[model samples]
Structures are given as C-alpha cells and as structure tokens.
Target: MLNTQWRVLFVFIVLLIASALIANHLTGRVFNYHDPIGSVRAIYEDIKTKIEMAEESELTAIKTIAAPSLSAKTAMQKHLPQADTTRCVDVSLGKVKYKRNGNIYTWTDSNGVPHFSDEKPDFEAATLDTDFVEPLDYFELTLHAANLPPSFTEELRIKLNTVFKVYGQIIGVDALKKVRLNLTVFATRRSYEQAIKLRGADPTNTDGMYFHSTNSALINYRNEQSAMRTAVHEAVHAVNKAILGSTPRWLNEGLAEYFEYTKNSMQLVSVEPHPGWVNNKRVAQSVFTINWLIGLDDTWQTGDDTKLYASSWAAIYFMMDSNKGKQFLKSIMLAEQKSPCSKLTAAELKNMLYQHFPQLDKDYRQWLKTPFRKQSF
Candidate 1:
C-alpha cells in the first residue's frame, strides 16, 4: 500500500511539471502573457495616431512657409501698374507694367496718357531753359517812343495790320487770330543795323526778315511812308509763315516787295528784265521795273541772286490776279510741306503755273509789251 501511494505521488509531480512546461510554451507562442499582446496592440494604435498627427503638422508647416511667398507675389502684381504694349519700347522715366492688351505706366493712365499730377515728371518744364511767354490771342499796341519818331512806329503798325488782313483774307482770319504781334521801337539805327548784321543780313534791305527768336519785328524810322512799307513787307512774310508753313525765299522776298510798292494802290506797272537789276536798283525799283515789262517765265533758278526779287514779285502778282492762281499757290504750299524747292524742276513749275493761270500766258505777254504810266508815291 505504501509503494502504490508513493508511485501515485510521483506521477502527480510529473503531471504537474508537464502542465507547467506546456503552459509556458502556449503563452510564448500565442498570447505572450509576460509582454501582454493587448498592451502591444494599444501601443501600435497610439503610434499610428501620432504618425498621422505628425504628417498633418508637417503639411501645416509647409503651407505656413509658402503662404507669405505667394501673398507677396500677389501683392506685387496688384500694386504694379500696366504698360503701353502698343508703343515701341518706352525709355521714359516711369514705372512700367506689361498687360495682355496694352502696357500701363505708373505715371500715366490706362492708354499711357499723361495727367496733371504733382508727383508726375514734368516733360515740358524740364526742357524749357528760357523764360517763355505763352502766345496771346489779341495784342493791344502800346507804342513807347524813345529816339524813334512816334509817327513812324504808328504808321508801321498800321501797314503791318493791313498786310496781316490781306493774308488773313487769303488763308482765313482764324489762322492769325491767335498770333500776338508785339512791335518794339528802337531809338538808334545802329541798334537795328547791328541786329540785322548779327543775323548775316543787310540792314539796308527795306523788307526786313522775320526774327523767330522774339516773335518781334523791327523797322527803322527813315520816313513814315517808307517805314510803313517796310513794316507791311515784313508782316506779310510773318503772315505767310502763319498761313503757309513757310513762303519760299523767293516768294517771301518778292511778296515783301509787292506789299512795299502797292499798299492798296491800283495802278498798272511794268517790270524791267535785266540781269543786273537786282544788284543795281533797290528791291522796290527792281520789282517795279520788271512788273512793267513782259516775257518773264515762272520757272526761276535757285540762288540766281539776279532778278530773283523781280521774277518773284511778278510770279506772285500773276498768281494773285488769276482764278486758278490762288489754288496753284495752295498746291505749291502743300508741295513745300513734302519737298524742297531744289527738288522741283523748272519745267514742272512752269506746267504748274500754266495749269493754274491759263490766261496768264496771253495777258501777261500782252501786258509786258504795252506801255503804262508810272505812278510815283
């Protein structure tokens, strides 16, 4: 009985030992009871949540870093003005911006047009070096006499106004309506002569040329009638420039002579045809002599220096008298805008003259042969 009881006890101890080993194996393979599988699963879920949160945080950081750069670019685009794309590259001092349709400058409007802005750059003001008086529409004459005769200046102004009226009639009064004529008289002939000589011109030339510098015309006081004629002559030249771009040098000097001699006198005059006429006689004498004679052609040479004044006066008179003469003058004026006189040939000019004044061919030829009484002023 004792041996059987001991055997049972040994069996029980072996069974207990085997049970312990099996439980250890099972725990290691399936559940891992020492490490706790549920705890490991909870740790994995926490790690995954942390990883997702980290990713979101990194994305937010990237956006925050990029926001300012994008905002800055947008702000710059909004602040900048557009530019004028139609115009060639603008070198003007202003901020420029390019657009789809046109370019806009910072200082200018949508069409790249300028505005009266205090901050805007002054284009005209910057270039103006001298004290410039803006032109007036109508000028009131105030003749202050020093050494010059008061009558001479007064008569000069009257003759000037008359020639101005003549040209105004031809090219419309509105053309010269805005021109301001200021005539200042000088006491000494030396001053007037010095002024002319400075311009590389002869002072004795009765028809004084226009001075573009001051817009002021000067005439010497020799006699009232002569001074009046000189004033009218110069004033016509100025009027011609106002109406027509510029009267040809020949036409200009000739017209000046015409005004000097005629001045509203209705008399038949003949012109002498001589090469030395311009050199020997005064401008008035040369022109008057030629007006009395005939066989003169409208085709005049450039810088002929002889008979220039005479031929010019006759041509101008011929044109002024004919129906188509005025139209031809207009054509000549228009042509001058495109080309110089040297470019036009003698034949072309002759054809133009004939086309304008067909009656000139016969009447002028007959007038040249006929003798007329000369009227003295």
Candidate 2:
C-alpha cells in the first residue's frame, strides 16, 4: 500500500514538472534555439534525480510516523498504578490467635517436600519471617479487646478491610489509600459505650459509630455477626470521609448499609435476599424525596430511624443497579475537599446530582416501586 502511494505521488510529480518543462522549452526556443535535445535530456536527468531523492525522503517520513515507540509505551505504563494481588486481604495473619512472636516455623519432610506448622523443630527446620500485615500509610485499626477470640477478631478485621477494598475499587485506591481511618474494637457493650461517651458521642441506641472529627470508627461487640456488620458499616464511613471528605447523609448511610451485608467480595457476591433495611418495606413509604435526600446536609433528626435508613439504602440500591446510576454515584464521589477539611455546598452537590441523573426524583421513586429483591445489585 505504501509503495502504491509513493508510485502515484511520483507519477503526479513527473506530470507537473513535465508541464513546467514544456512551457520553459517553448520560451527558450522562441528566444534562441540550439541543442534542444541535449538541453531537454539534461533537464530530464536532473528531475529524475531530484524525484528519486524526494521519494526516499518521503518514505523515511512515513516510516518514522508509522513506527510505535516501545520506550514511550513503557514510560506511560510506569505511571499507572499496578495492582498488588497480595494487598487483597480476605483474612489477616496480623491478628495472631496464639503468640509465636513475629516469625512462622517451617520444615522439610523426608520426601524433600515443604511442611508448615506453628511449632519449631529440633533440627533441619527453617524459620520463615512472616510479619503481620502492615497498615496502609493512611489507615490503621486497633482491636482493644482482651476477651474476644483472636480468630474471630481477625475475621472481623478482614471484613472491614474488604469494605475498604470495595470502596477503593469504586472511589479509587489512590484516594482511599490516603484515607486516615482509625478503627477500634471494644470487647463488651459497656466498654464500647464508655469509649463513645468519652468521645462525646451519645451511644444511646447504636451498635457502632464513626466519629468524623477524629476520622475513627468505634464498635460494640454485641454478637459475632452483628458486630462484624457494624464494623464493616463504620469502616465504609471512615473510607468515605477519607476519600470524599464528607458525603450527604443518605449517601453515607446507604453505602454503609450496602457494605454491611455484602461480604468478602467487591460486589454483591451472594445477591441473597436478606431482611435488611435495603429490603425493608418502609423504603416505599419514605418521606425522603430524591431532592430532599440530595439537599440534606446534617439534620439527621428525622424522627423515624427505620424509614430514614431504609430510604437511604433504597436510594443507593437504585443508584448502583444500573451503569448510568453508578456513573451518577461516581460523580458525587469525585467531589473531594477543596480547602482543608472543607466540603462542597448543598447547592453544588445538588447540581451534580441533577446533572448526572436529571429526573432523579421521579426515577428514584419509580425504582423503589419495582420488585424488591433485585435491589441487591
């Protein structure tokens, strides 16, 4: 194809120069004609030489443009964040059930196969330095408990980090990674309540609470399953504040409720129909209009906790169920802090919401009226 182009270009150049040469020859002959064949032959040789050189130059230019630079591609790839599979924590060895200091013991069997155990051998054994999982630069969790099983505590920690990963995938790891999340787990309800009280939070009817001032999560271990859910829920809030600075009440609560139940995976792994606030029938009768939910700043005194939570959960469920919905949600998430700890005004956030989902009020209400279980998306 390139050769064809070059040949056609050469032919066009030859035709153009031939026309010019004919005109020049006529003018020269009118003035003084002598050795016209020699003059024409000399002109033809010069044009041919120049055209050949021009064609080579043109081919060089085309080749330069056609070739891709492997060095440039490698440089671009260096700027992109590489995925670390080791960073995905479904379980944490950091929460050691039994103390073995910091190292894990390993040995080889008679068949020259590797064997692993917590026990140290008398001879022919090597110790593998398996350190506890280090915390991210901006995130840390401390389990302040003396009675809870270390195994269960590790499981809870895994679930919480999974929440971080889930939102990290959504909001971006760069943002979530810089999030300063401090989570503390209390062994008993009495101690948990005391801790929240000391933080000046009224722990009247809550299993867990996320204090935005300190960017920390405080949890009460009432039961294994419930406490795990609460920890996951609060972890989402910590992540939210770290990434977005502050989110609307509906968004904050909806995300919390979403991750609270969805376990061990980035998405709804089971998609199971559970009797959570998201599946609550009260969402259908919620007082929150789409506009109201978007405009709400900090006034959470809605009188009915169930309906409020259910409404928020429903709105988030509807937003996450479609590609457009997820896009809309992502738009709001990108509203990061402008000043130090500053937030976007209600008007700004409202504009973003409408811009992304114009008929959000009507569309949200319509979505809530759909069949219930599929909200798991």
Best candidate (score: TM-score)? 2
lDDT of 1 by residue, 1-377 (tens): 99999999898667555544544443332323455545345445655676799998898778657653323312211110011122222111121122232222234456977544324254432222233222222233444346556666655555555554445445444344433444444456677678667755555433244564444466665445545555555555544443443334555556666566443333323223222222333323334332222223332321223345556666565556544666776566556434421333445555666676566557665554443322222
- As for candidate 2, its clashing pairs are none
| Per-model TM values vs. the true structure | 0.44, 0.56
lDDT of 2 by residue, 1-377 (tens): 99999999898667656645663754332211355445556566666777799998898778657855433312211110011223212221121122335567898788999888768777767888885443333346665555567886677666666565555445554444444445677787799889878966667666777765555677777667766677667777766655565556677777777666664455444222224542354343445776676666454542245555666777676766777777777667776533314456778777877887888777877867767654332
* Collision count for each candidate, in order: 16, 0
lDDT against true structure, model 2: 0.59
CA lDDT, every model vs. true structure: 0.46, 0.59
* C-alpha RMSD for every candidate: 38.2, 24.8
**Least accurate stretch of 10 residues (summed lDDT) in model 1?**
75-84
